[model samples]
Target: KYSQMPRSVGGLNAAGEWYVLRSMIPGLKDKKVLDLGCGFGWHCRYAREQGAQFVVGVDISARMLERARATTHDTAIEYRQQAIEDIDFADGSFDVVISSLALHYVAAYEVVCRKVFRCLAAGGTFVLSVEHPVFTALAAQDWYYDEQGQRLHWPVDNYQQETLRQTRFLDTDVVKYHRTVATLLNTLMDAGFRITTIAEPQPTAEVIAAYPEMKDETRRPIFLLVAAVKPV
Candidate 1:
C-alpha cells in the first residue's frame, strides 16, 4: 500500500498542489519564476498557466521530472532534477520562488530557505505552502467506522509544541518535520524574507456539508499558505 501511495497520489500532483496553485495570488505575468521541489511538474504547469515568462522547476526525483517534462512542452518551462539543500542558482536570480508541499521533507529546511533567499531578486516574492502542523499532529492517531460511516475513534491530541516524527503510510514511512507557527515565522525571518501574508485554508464548505466526517468541532488548520518578500 505504501508503494502504491506514491503512484496513487499522482507523484506530487497531490491536493496540496491544488491548494498551492490557488494560494499563489496571481501576478505571475511575464515573471521569471522558480518552482522549487516541483515534483512531476504539476504545479509548474499551473505557474505557466498563470503567465510566467520563464519558469524553471527543480526536483530531485528523476522519474517524476521526466513525466513533468513530457507533460509540459512549453519552451518557457524548464524542469531539472536537483537537490533542494543545495541548489544550482546564482544570487538574485528569480523574481518569484515557490515551493508546494515539499519543504518539510528535508530536515535541513533552513538551508533551502537560505538558498531561496539567495536566489530571489530584491523585492521578489517567495510563496510557499506546507501541510499544516495540525495535520501532521493528527496523523496516524485512529479512525473507525461508526454506525454511519468512517470517523475518528480517538481525540486529536498531539499539537504539543512542534515535535517531528517519521509517519508511515501503511507500508512506506517518511519523516515529517512539524514546525510551530513560531518556528516557521522565525525561520523565514532569519532567512531574510519578510512575512507579507499568511493564510490557513479550510476545506471547501461543500465538502463539510456533504460529509459529516469532514466537519470540525473546533477549527483545525489542514493547510498553510505563506507569502514573503525579499526586501529591496
Candidate 2:
C-alpha cells in the first residue's frame, strides 16, 4: 500500500500554487478537462467533484500515476503517464486545460503554448502556474540567509537570461528553464490566447499564522498564475 505524502491546505504550495490555480478555474460543470503534470490526481479529483464530464490526468512519473490510481475511484477520470513536453491531444479536444508548476521544466514553453492553443476548443480555458521568474532567476533558488540563519533577502540574478538553470530539488539534481514575465504572457498572445487573468499569489493571514515559514513568501512572489482563453 503506497500512501501519499502529507500535504496541508496551508502548506507552501497550497498558499501559492493551489490557491491561485483554484481561483482561476472557471465553471467546470460537464466540461472536458485535461490536467498536465497532475501528480497524485488531486486536481483531477477536484474537477470531478465540480461535475466535470471527463478528466484526463497526465504526468511523467509512472509511480505517481500508480498512486493516483490507487487513490481515485472515479470512472470518469483517466490517468496517463506522459511528459508535459510530449503532450499531444486531439484538436479541440478539451474545454479546460490546466498545468501547475510544470512549464518551468520544459525547455520550449512556446511549443507547448502553440500545442495548447491548437488543441483547445474555441472559448476553451487554459490555466497554468509556474515558478515566478524572480524565483527562478537565481541558480541557487534560495533566499539569502545570514550566518545566524535568518533570511536576509531574496536575490534576483540574471533576470534577463532566459536559459536552462541547474538546481537541486528533492535531493535530486534537476534542470529547469527560466523565462521572463513578458515572454510568458507574450507567448500566450502569440499563440492566439486572450490573456484573462494574471496573479502573483499572496499567502493569506490564516495560512501565515498556521505555517510561519510561509511568512517569508510574502516578501517575494513564488509562483505566477495565468489564465487565458481561445477566442470563440
Candidate 3:
C-alpha cells in the first residue's frame, strides 16, 4: 500500500504521515533503540544514520526481515523475526522503542505495554501509531458513498465496543483489534508510563496539493500517534 510514498526518516506511507510520526522521535545519537513490528527496518536504518549506538528491528514476517536484511548493510543494525506480542528484551536494554501501525493487530495490548516498559531504560520513550478507533469501529471500514462514487460521510459505530474487526487491504483480509481511546490511554498509565503526546495527524496542505486524492485525509484522521516516557 505504501509503495509509491515519499521516503522519510521512518519510512513511506500514504499521506506522508511518516514525517509526522518521525517528528515525535527524540534524538537518536548514542541511543540504543528497538523497533517492534519493524517491517522493512526503515526506522532502524534511519536510527543508525542518526548515530544510534545500536538498533534492533523485530517483525513477525520472515519475508519482511529478509528484505530488511538484504537492504541494510550497517553492522550496528540487527533484524529479528518476532511477533510484537511475544517481544522480549532485558530490562533497560533500550533507550527508545517505536512501533508504527502494528499494535492494533495484537489482542493483548496491555501485555505488550508492560513488556515495553520493562525493556526500556529509565526515561526511555515509546512512540507508536495505530489506526484511529473511529476508523476501525466502522463496519468494513467503509465510507458512505453517493451514486457518483463520491465519499459522503465517514460512519462511526460501536464507538464503545472493543473487539476484533476484519478489513480488506492490499487485496487481503486482515484482522485488527479495535479499542476505545480511553482503553489505549489507560493501558499506558496502568503500565506505569507517563503520557507525553497524542496526535491525530492530517495531511498538510502541501501534501494535499501534490496528491489531490489525499485531500479527504483532512476530513478525518486515519491514524493516531502516541508518545509516552518511562519515569526516571
Which residue runs of candidate 1 sit more than 4 Å off their true CA positions? 1-23, 138-163, 206-219
lDDT of 1 by residue, 29-119 (tens): 8888998888877667777887888899999889878878877889989888888786869999899998877887777778888989999
Give lDDT for model 1. Answer: 0.74
Q: What TM-score goes with each of the models?
A: 0.80, 0.93, 0.94
Reference-based lDDT, residue 169, model 3? 66
* TM-score comparison, 1 vs 2, better candidate: 2
lDDT of 3: 0.87
Q: What is the number of residue pairs that collide in model 2?
A: 0
Candidate 3 — which residues are off by over 4 angstroms?
1-10, 13-15
The C-alpha lDDT values of all candidates are: 0.74, 0.87, 0.87
Clash numbers, per candidate? 0, 0, 0
Worst 10 residues of 1 by lDDT: 7-16
